[model samples]
Target: MIEVSKGIYWVGAIDWEIRDFHGYATPKGTTYNAYLIVDEKVALVDTVKEPFRDELLSRVGEIVDPAKIDYVIVNHLERDHFGSFAQVMDVAKNAKVYASGRGKKGIEEVYGERWDVTAVKTGDTLGLGKRTLRFVETPMLHWPDSMFTYVEPDRVLISSDAFGQHVAGSQRFDREADPHALMEDAKTYYANILMPFGTLIQGLLAKVPSLNLAPEIIAPDHGLIWTKPGTIIDAYGRWSKFEARDKVVIAYDTMWESTGKMAHLIARGAIDGGVEVKLFHLRKSPYSEAVTEIQDAKAFIIGSPTLNNGLFPTVGGFLYYLKGLKPKHKIATAFGSYGWMGGAVKEIVARLKEMELELAEPALDLRYPVTKQQEQECIEFGRKIAKQVKEAKQ
Candidate 1:
């Protein structure tokens, strides 16, 4: 166990073997962070996943007896945070559980009404001698039951999932991890998991300042603790506003070589047009990674080869995933090659429109094997997108 603050310790588990979280990829795995705040009344904030119950308890046992925990704070009721609830409550038999109103209801619904739980709201405070724990209801900051616990006098904010990364390592704080790598992991986590709730995040960020929560340290439920809270908070501010850089993202899947050729030529034009370009073959790369690149990109161009008069399976699936994310303020267009009949490009354009992305150009489609002339058209297509991206940035 590592001491995060003077008396508060990190009693969490590292899941280095997990390569995937639901559908989001976790190449470096992740950590389920739980904080143990030792004061006049010992309070254990959050718990690890069910599989890591032994590791979590072992760390807590080192500081104090598991049964001695006086209060259990449920920051979030999601399975990853609450999976070991039964085991923890079993050990800390006399500990009182405190959670957001929705969190308490969710806990009761899932585990029944056997345990003693107190429903809390925003502005609620619990005193433990020198430190005071303040609750802030942050619904849909990713989850409805999500909340943050601010430890006053210590100036630490135990954030549920906000400002978190899906990374696991021996390091316990941002200072110990490579700055660039840590931020990239945090970006990927945000793109895949929290992209749909940008507006809510903006509101939360504004609320934090007004509530006078000037946290010196921000401890999230995943990844490392943020010693420099402003770094992540600044990034979150830009992201929550859907801010974009002068970059273009091209993603496609080809049945043969036709669509692949178009993607490469388009990428070349975008590169030559003086903007950053990220190209992805959906079948070969993880969708999570492509989404991360698109998160801050000014424009997105998608290509697909028709199969049985419909979108290529990979492209269609990617669009479905992208639609759910609801990426905003992006310039998007579609292109494809078809045999006999053309329908894939139209479907792609429709989906893009459904997501409310601005269409940069009319959907481009070429027949069967793309000729030399059609290839130049693809190059021009990329150049046009690059121009749009640059113009948007200006």
Candidate 2:
């Protein structure tokens, strides 16, 4: 176990083989971080996945006997963070579990009240001798049962999932990883999982200051801990506000080369208009990565070929995925090429509207095998989006 503070230890398991988290890609794998605080009273904050239960217990044994654990603090009821709960309880049979109100209900619903669990709320504190664990409710920061555990005197924040990244490494702290790469992973994780909760995140960022919850070390349930808390705190502030850059992301899926050609031409136009452009062929790229690019882009253009009188399966699936993410304050439009009749562009526009993204222009559709004229029009459409993105930046 790595010591994060005087008495706080990181006893999490690193998952180097995991490549998929539900649907979100985790190419770099991830860690299920559980912190161990050994003061007068012993507390285990969170647990690893069920498969990593042995690793967790072993880590706990490095510092103290698992049976000696006095309290099991569950900051989130999500399985990734609490999957080893049953096994941990089996060993620490006398330890009591503490979680948020909704968290307590969720635990009982799943485990049937077989264990002793206490419901906590914001401002609640659990005295662990010199160090105290303070509770803060952060509902819908991805899950209804989510919350954070702040360790006093140590000034360590055991953030459940916030500021987490899907990355695995022997290094435990942010300072150990390349700053840019770490931030990129963090952005990808946030874009895929927490993008929809931007407003709630903004509220939480504001609330932290009011609660005087400043942390010298910020430990999340996944990835590396933050020794320099300001970097991640500032990043969360920007991301939660949906602050964007002068960039455009073009995502498309093509049955033939028509839509692909359009995507390339559009990207060219946007680049020419002095905006950074990221182009993704949805079939060839991960939706999680695409959303990460879109998260920072001021505008995004999506294209899909018609399939069965609707959107292409990949495009349709991506739209539903993007819709749930609820990205805001962005300009968007749809474009596509269809065979006999066109429906993909219309459907794409409808989905964009449903997402509440401002349409920079009407959805553009070209007949099968776009003519040179239509190709030029696609370029102009891209230019228009780039202009809109620049204007938004201003």
TM-score per model over all chains: 0.99, 0.98
Error (Å) of candidate 1 at residue 190 is 1.0
* Alpha-carbon lDDT of model 1: 0.92
Question: For residues 1-394, what per-residue lDDT tens digits would candidate 2 score against the true structure?
Answer: 5999988999999999999999999999999999999999999999999999999999999999999999999998888989989999999989999999999999999989898899999999999999899999999987899999999988999989999999998989999999999999999999999999999988888788788898999999999999999999999889888889999999999988899998999988888889999989988989998999989889999999888899999999999999999999999999999988889999999999999988988778888987988888988888888888888852
Clashing pairs in 1: none
C-alpha positional error of residue 37 in candidate 1 after TM-score superposition, expressed in Å? 0.4
**Superposition error at 73 for model 2 (Å):** 0.4
Candidate 2: segments with Cα more than 4 A from true spot:
none
State model 2's lDDT: 0.92
- Stretch of 10 with least lDDT, candidate 1: 385-394
